[model samples]
Target: NALTPPNFIKSIIEEDLRSGKVKEVVTRFPPEPNGYMHIGHVRAIFIDFALADEFGGRTNLRFDDTNPAKEDVEYVNSIKEDIKWLGFQWDNQYYASDYFDEMYNRAVLLINKGLAYVDDQSADEIRENRGTLTEPGKNSPYRDRSVEENLDLFTRMKNGEFKNGERVLRAKIDMASPNINLRDPVIYRISHTTHHNTGDKWCIYPMYTFAHPLEDAIEGVTHSLCSLEFEDQRPFYDWVVRECEMEAQPRQYEFGRLNVSTMVTSKRKLRKLVEENLVDGWDDPRMPTVSGMRRRGYTPEAIKSFIYETGISRSQGLIDIQTLEHFVREDLKLKAPRTMAVLRPLKVVITNYPEGESELLPAENNTENEEMGIRQIPFSREIYIEQDDFMEEPPSKYFRLFPGNEVRLKHAYFIKCHDFIKDENGEVVEIHCTYDPATKSGSDFNARKVKGTIHWVDASSAVPAEFRLYEPLLGEDEESEELAADETNDVSADEVDDFLKKVNKDSMEVVQGFVEPQLKDAQPQDKFQFFRHGYFNVDPKLSEPGKPVFGRIVSMKSSFKL
Candidate 1:
């Protein structure tokens, strides 16, 4: 963590503190509780918590629940869990709805100052009038309404007298401004839906843009850090705090949003994937959600380390997802116990070894971590090796278990394949081999050298398990096309359909396997390095007593380096 590169945001915070421009570096992670937090949110969460903590300041966990129709308590709870799991705790917790009354009062103040007006334009009409970047916007006919009439209309709208979108309160800003966001944006809209927090107490809700700045000011947040997409709205943010006469002004700062290649962080797309049964749920191991990564055995240390290394900047760069996997591997290598798990198991009968006889072999839990000590693995006459480990006709350089070729069985004896059994379909079902007793592991039997080492589990003691291997849900090329088509994040139904079509059907593959008996009691979330296979974590949601399910966290090798 100390080696993480310093970011411009940190420099700005230091200068602010040094100049007495900021008394304390109070920040907030305000997430709308509409969906689970994804990997993309990790950047914001880290910046908010880390920067504040670095300055001996505090951060607040605020739920931007202004959009009651889309928000839910489930998302709120999940967000909190994710933040805690990442090892950062908020100094205070707040919700945007908690200050709805205050926000309404502020709107009233704006109306009183003749800085806001009631707009009766239809949503379509409003959009049409809000001209493009090349043109200036046209003022609403209702924009110049008298202060008294505007106040009465806004009050009536809040009283549930107006249907949803029938009326809205608009800030009376410039219509001819080059920045279209300053063109009298809608500040409030009538929504009759019940709020998760407020219930039926209120019928109208403040727009997110209008409510966010007020929430920051009310909470005394000194720095309102957000993604680059919100940079265009910073002017409105400042306008709200200043015109509303908020005693505590929170300045807004923008940082580049983290984007990972081949990752879909759009909440709508994620929700569609779950609803359409394209994925198991939000916590599917293949998902990019924090819960998903956690369930897949990604460590908090790895995620935090990834965030630090990625750093913060004004340039939005597409990061290779492998960089993240690199961190996970780095964090897990020494911690996870090493064990053998034969996926696609092929029964191997050591004909020369005595039948019904088994012995315990000592194997280091982790070669690099002697502190983990050693674990006893079962070795027997009959054992299961990876099907791919043996070949009747092997190519050159294939040093594993070809006929007459000897290979060391990890933690056991060197075994030489002599013959194999084939099913009626001519598929190799089993292999016949002979183990050299003199070549037992830990013995001083280096009479000859073997070119290959393979891993296996004792057939008698191997635990039946399920291994869930994963690939990226979206291919890199498809993801690039999707991003190019949908830059606004406002996905349409057709776009969703097209995106779903691009979902990799083979993203996940479940195969029955055998793990060493030492893993028979492996609890959910327990992590281990499968010998010559990959790193895996016990599936928290599916693993049951005596029937463990392991999700491959990452492969054993990666071309990427940190």
Candidate 2:
């Protein structure tokens, strides 16, 4: 697993390198500046940067900003931050709109060469004329227009003479081509909206299919790598480069995209989650955005290692979300400090021990990492253990604290339960126990051992905190579904409703808890592994001075093996 396995695209790059087909490799991550980047983008990001780096090459961070209606500066900044947080740096940053003048001139060149023509057909009319996969499409009525007239009209259209949907520029490719993408796909459409970068300098914008190929060519990108979903668009990509006659030709190769089993990667569906208030924002901890994972306590090293383990393959299948959690736990085992946190507090009074007194008990920071050293935790006569740790009438074989059973307090002393109190609702509220000072942990004395050890915090010194436990964000994982509605270039209202229905309403549960006093100065993003709980990150957004909100990254135990 040390060396990356061979895949189709990697083979192609290796072959290209061996035959001197390329000297230096140049790749680009051209993300559309429309929405926040998600985990799926991490795969493409890894592929683009890793492939180029393998060959001593460079990768460019380019924003395909052709559609101005949905793009904004916020998405652009988030994308950069996500990439940086992912630990990959781009050699250069460029926007698709940066080459608007050249794109417009290229449109004019296509017109002059009779390879393009401006059509007056409405969008619905064009769709109606564009035949299905089994049927041949008919040419536009404006297909036979003279080159001079088409050029004049295209210039006027660019000059804002025509309203949106009134006209569009189409490729002069074969209308009867078996590949429907080659059936005179519209290359440019009129949009009156101002671009985030270009402002009102241009109203006629090039389509993604048209602008993508040209952008790569202009940047001298040698290899354009992307997901297999774009395989069909490769032909149109080649067409624009060949017909437009660019100096540099970036060959496109497709690989299977990374799809986690229990999450949605569709941008539109994710946008729906944000707009419908089902999620806090694009970076909501439940959402699968890179920022979401970061905020949820996922480390860059862990994420990168997880991707490396997933490998670069052409036949990616449904990756279990547990696999990701596995890597997260593995990375934190030695790195994150081992600490005790009582999530749901159950007051325990040491009736026979010294009352109104607390003692400092030595606790190891991490058993696996001794170099992290040790810290002393304050243990009081009236300490707080997890509410679930004590069952007044536990079932068979339950060795935890019961009416008469004894359990060891982790890193402290063995405590025997004597009595319990209940509220009017018949719910157990308080417990009475007696701690044997001779049985204190790390003591040179040995006594009778207990099968159960539960974590607890000092009542007087424990810092109050909030614990946020998260589950699968969606109730229905994308089982065999191949593509999101957006991939088909359409998302229906019914589909949105159905996706919304699958959202897990119980995705998050917040409860007040107590942590060791050492966490009093724990700043945002501090990570810790709680005994019997899970790895947690200090919530950067909701954490306040002396009171932190911890987001559970993953539990300590897992059924996943590799």
Candidate 3:
């Protein structure tokens, strides 16, 4: 982490520590447990944990579960798992709901100070009156209610005396302020729903803007780091902390968020994909979610390295997804074992070889990693090669397989295609080739040279597998389409339909393939580099005994340079 380049946030923290403005650097990763964490959250997680750890401070994992209508325990558990998976352990775990009683008291204190009031305006009515950027908002009719009356009404609201959204508590801020967020923003709303953590303990819920600062102050958080979108909300954030008169005042800082090309990081869009059965689930490999990337075989080291390389900045830029993929390849190059997996299998028969015999051939597990040593691969009379490797009618410079052409079978022998059998539909059903004993692999046979070499798996002992190849979920043209900038934004039905239309139909392709018998026992999450097929991870959810499913993490090659 010391190698990480110093950015503005780091400089600020250093100044704060040096000037004694802060006794310690305490940060918190407060995510609402309404959905799964995605790659976009990686930068915040890194900054929070790394900066706090570097300063010998602590970081807390806090769930901002203010909106119980969308929050659930299932999402909370998934978030915790994701943080741990990213190689971070929180100093303490807390939830906003834990301080509901204290938060209520703080709201009451605001009411007593004449800084807040209860509003009877409906949500739509409030929105309609809350003016646009060019105009000032009109004050609510109930904004002038006396402190005692507001307190009584707020208490009744908490007692579930009103239906959902019938009333809300608003701060006594300027309605004519240029900043829309300062226009007497709703601080609390009546929601008669059970919270994931608090259950049916209360019907009134504090809004996120109000509960966030309170939670930070209650936890003694020194710095509350959030994305640039919250930069405008900082005024209100400070207002809540100052007006509520919290014992501990936590300052808010904003940094640009990480955005990837062609990735939909919005939780609403992601949820729609899952809810509508457009994707396999939240952990679908094509998704940009942390759990999805994990299932896709991305290593924690790769993700961390990518975030570090991106660094901290104030400009929100779209990073090429290939840049992230480059890190995955770098991390996996030496770690994953090299093996052969024949996707789209083409049966090849070594007609001249001993019909019923097979032999073990020596193959290095990883060419670049000597410590991996060697592995024995079975070679028999019949084997499976990739279908695209061969061509009955060849093209120029094609160096894989063709009729009457000799090509070295990787880790095996020199085999020359002689004949091919065709089905009634004129499809090539099988290929017949003959192997020369004198040209065995690792031998000093220089008498004949083959212009091509291809990889294969012994059909007799191969493990049948399902291969899932993936592409970007959204098409290139759709990449620039604007989505909800914030995760909490509500997406309309038309928006969902328009987004779905842009989804690439060919995002994933499934094919039955065969891998070397050595991978027969490959467990879920086990990673490997298939010869000519890039890297793959065993599908955790779909893979079963004897028929393992492999998801292609990335291809064998990329034009992307770091």
Candidate 4:
């Protein structure tokens, strides 16, 4: 009664089951393990696994590792880890190489049936003869060889007698079909390359089009869902399935791929970026790759929520990257605890307060999570405020510190600035203020209202640390262009290289900053809100004992106003 729930191929599967033509459903996520899976693949994997689960069917994780020259065991492991991280487990892990022997025998069957031939033409020559979209392709001169001759040559190819790229086995499909995939597609090619799994046993390897359907049929997949780009290839895929004489005859369905703004997603292009050192690695936080997002603190739940909000439309669309960040903020707001740290320090001396005296101030761990409880912050005579908090000559709307102005030192005392000292470069170095002892925080005497309540770090008891401010990898205009041509992916492969170029010239400006002494014992991955500045988390890769590096996740607000 589930009726495959209405998508193209699924609807067919549902109808078949209802009509007693089939009993169960089966689907597969077949990724070519040449590189780390990107955010786009996340959607495909979820759809493949979820659809089968919904219909009481099974899903297989199949590696289309036909191109051994590019595939690696590293990618295979990463693929598995990513799937498990997303909370999906495959019924079985299958590899295209597992059917190498069967695929070879099937090729022999086609040759014996006089439906395929061995072509000695080079790759370039084959492309030249394939013709354009407007014209029909020409058949190979060797296309008319006898079945015995083709079979003998193919057998020799299997025996590794031919060098790499010397010859290829092509199906005897139509050259006049408008769909170029049907133009006698290449079924087997000489690679002479050692595979990650089957090793050098395969000098002649099966092509993706030839290997994928075999993988599905062998695994008993009833619906083979793929992207819209493969729509034209479905006919050829079906032809090969029929020629191979599959009993189940798995159907192919197409859907639009996930495309996001500000990033390029092609594996080849991403690899180029990595090779060219345009990025740090595949998992660079700037990359649109799933690994990159993970390192940047994105949760799988947030990613899934973004996908759901984007909706599943037949028409291809590009979603703004900001939409993703929005969901991340929404999720973390309720989950992450809040703390305070100063990025740029400016000294403030309380002239009226007794020297060397300190008090423990109570601060909320997270206003959103009261159960997290309160933490004690040490406050003393000499403290450090944000450098931007005080100006000798402030603008009319600037509510912070200036001569004769009163502001509340957050969670402590109200102070009135009287004087300031500056360095030779004219930068405000320090400020002198008078604190109202009667106006102690959390007391009935703290009745006086102030225009601003600024965060402060006790200078004598503060911890010295590194604060990293991250900006978008590229500017709005440049990122827009990169997103527009994702299919042509000329951007970063390793992203670190591209990041070096696209870095906001002032992306990371080092400053002498201070944090409350309580953070001195904080370890990596510990997150905090820098009071009025922004939300941040410790940099796992950069932080060290006694020298912590904090990465700014997002500011308290979007862009700063003048």
lDDT of 1 by residue, 1-562 (tens): 4323598878888899999989889999998888999998998999999899888899999998888888877998999999999999999999889999999999999999999999999989999999988998998999889999998998899888989889989999999888777899888988889888999999998888889889999999999998887888889999999999999989999988788888887888889999998888999999989999999899999998998888888777788888999999999999999989999899999999888888899999999999999989988889999888888888888888988999999888999989999999999998999988999999979899999998899999899999999999998755432232111345778988999999998999999989999799999999999987789999999999999999999998742111
Per-residue accuracy of model 4 over 1-562 as CA lDDT, tens digit each:
4312345555666687899766787889998888888878877887788678877888889988777877787888989988887777899888888988888888888888888999999989988888879999999999999998998899899899999889999999888889888888888999888888898787898888887777788778888887766777788789878888877678888777787765656676567667766566887666677877766667777787776666544546777777887877787776677766777888899998898788898987788878888888888889988888888888889989999999988778899999999899988898999999877777866456888888888888889988877665555544332232111223444553554466444444445587878787777767676777666777667778877777776676565443
lDDT of 2 by residue, 1-562 (tens): 3224466677888888899998888999999877888888998998898778877889999998888888878899999999999888899999999999999888888988999998998889888888988899888999989999998899899899999989999999998889888899998999999888889998899988888889999999999998877788899999999889898989998878888877788777889999999888998888889999999999988888888888887776888888898999999999999999989999999898777777788889999999999998887778899888888778887878998888988888899999999999999999999988888888865658789888899899899999999987775455324652122353567877888888888899999989999998889999999988989999898898888999999987752111
Q: Which ten residues in a row have the lowest lDDT in candidate 2?
A: 479-488
| Global lDDT of model 1 | 0.89
C-alpha lDDT of all candidate models, in order: 0.89, 0.87, 0.89, 0.78
lDDT of 4 at 332: 75
Alpha-carbon TM-score of each model against the true structure: 0.96, 0.96, 0.95, 0.89
Better of 3 and 4 by lDDT: 3
Task: Please provide, for model 3 over 1-562, each residue's C-alpha lDDT reduced to its tens digit, 9 standing for 90 to 100.
Answer: 4734588888888999999999999999998888899888888898898888888889999988788888877898999999999988899998888999999999999999999999999999999999999999999999899999999999999988999989999999999999998999988888888877788989998988888989999999998998888888899999999999998989999888788888887787889899988899999999999999999999999999999889888778888888999999999999999999998999999999898998999999999999999999998999999888888898888877789888999988999999999999988879999999999888889997888878999999998899999999986545433333232555677877889888887899999989999798999999999987899999999999766899999997752111
Measured over all alpha carbons after superposition, the RMSD of each candidate to the real structure, in angstroms, is 2.6, 2.4, 2.5, 3.8
The number of residue pairs in model 3 that clash at the backbone is 0
- Tell how far residue 167 is off in model 4, in angstroms: 1.4
lDDT ranking, high to low: 1, 3, 2, 4
